[model samples]
Target: MTAISIAPAATRIPSRHRITKVMRLQMVNRLTYLGIPWIITGVALVISIVVAVLISVSVPEPGRQAALEGMAYSWAGLSPFWYLAVVGVQAVSAIFPFALGFSITRREYALGTLVTFVVIAAFNATGWAILTEIERAINAAGLTFHHFTALWFSEVGAGSVWLSLFTLQIVIFAVASAFAAVYARWRAMGMLVLWTAVALVVLGLIAFALLTGSAVPIIDWLMGFTITGFFAALLIPATLAFALGWAALHRAPLRG
Candidate 1:
């Protein structure tokens, strides 16, 4: 009898393990997602404080109080949001190809990327909530500086603040993810077309609102939303963007 040769069956990784691995892979460069954001936040805080102090000093004492009080909103608090968009784009564009080379399936990569977005959004939101409270306390102590405590956040309770921030971050990240996925699938030309389409759509909407004389009504409708309600409404677009990103990545090439 001839000796029989048999090959062992290939071991399959559980979906959960594969997903977790991808998440870990994305986080390997923690500085991009975590450290840099905080650094930017800190820089923004410092700039806000400096500007507040300068304005206070520039004004007469009688007007200084009014000046600071009038600062209902600070753009500095929004700096991190912009950086988070970059993080979202890099999360896919920079990592998708690498992940594929490691034998990660497209499904696994998409799901893992989404999970990472949620985790990062939650983490950043928590930080923002804490900072908002701290800023509130500082302002209450009579400093009158606004960094994390934007006017909208000041109007809401703490829970609402956290929820709104979480929603906003998720929306920003999801939209960026969609853009990055499009880039991955079609390269630079895809991004150009995407942005052109976005610009035209925005212009069309503006033109419609202007010509139809519904701009005020639209503004009023939007302004009527409570802080939480506004962010919650944003969930619609966020969901669509997330879905679009996933679908795009489903067939994205490994080399891109």
Candidate 2:
């Protein structure tokens, strides 16, 4: 006689434990992997200030000098957020294979990655909020430096500021994750096809709008929403992207 034991499927794939494991693994290389973008952003900020100062000193025109005084270099700070796309891409392109080696199921990995990205997005949004407030205070003190308080970023003293930032980050993260999953399953050709498909869709939409003479109405509709509302609306696409990304990764093959 032989004794045998079987565990339920749910026990085998407990969502909480699996997600925790993935999150822990993600944190292991957090410094080296996550810190690179922040470091580069800091260096760029310092360089831009130095360059601006040099330009201000050398340029002779009074109007040009005044224009340079309160230059809204908000785009500079935002450039690093794009690096998060690379982070998401690496999460799949690099870590997904390693996680699979540990026998983590695709469902668990995908959910865990989503949770991890949300947390990262929240963390970044909080930091950005703090920086934004600090920049505002500096401007009030007549420093004229604008690091985080761009017109599109937030309305002054508005509560939706953090929400808008978080929403934006989530949408960007979801898009990156979806793209990475596509690449993981299909590699270089997949990315090319994806880009081409996106281009065609955009072009087709433009043509349709032009032919229908509905471009103004469409633009007007878009203009009706506040920035926060517009970004909040992106949550729908973000959710869709997450679902699609999970589906893609579910059967995604390991790649080098």
Candidate number achieving the greatest lDDT relative to the actual structure: 1
TM-scores, all models, native as reference: 0.90, 0.86
Candidate 2 versus truth, CA RMSD in Å, comes to 3.5
lDDT of 1 by residue, 23-93 (tens): 88988988988999899999888887787889877998988887876666556677888989998899888
The TM-score of predicted model 2 comes to 0.86
**Candidate 1 residue pairs in backbone clash:** none
- With a 3 Å backbone cut-off (N, CA, C), the pairs that clash in candidate 2 are none
Q: What lDDT tens digits, residue by residue, belong to model 2 across residues 161-220?
A: 687778888988899989989888888898899899889999999999999999999999
Cα-lDDT of candidate 2: 0.77
RMSD of each: 2.5, 3.5
Model 1 TM-score on a 0 to 1 scale:
0.90
Residue 205's lDDT within candidate 1 is: 96
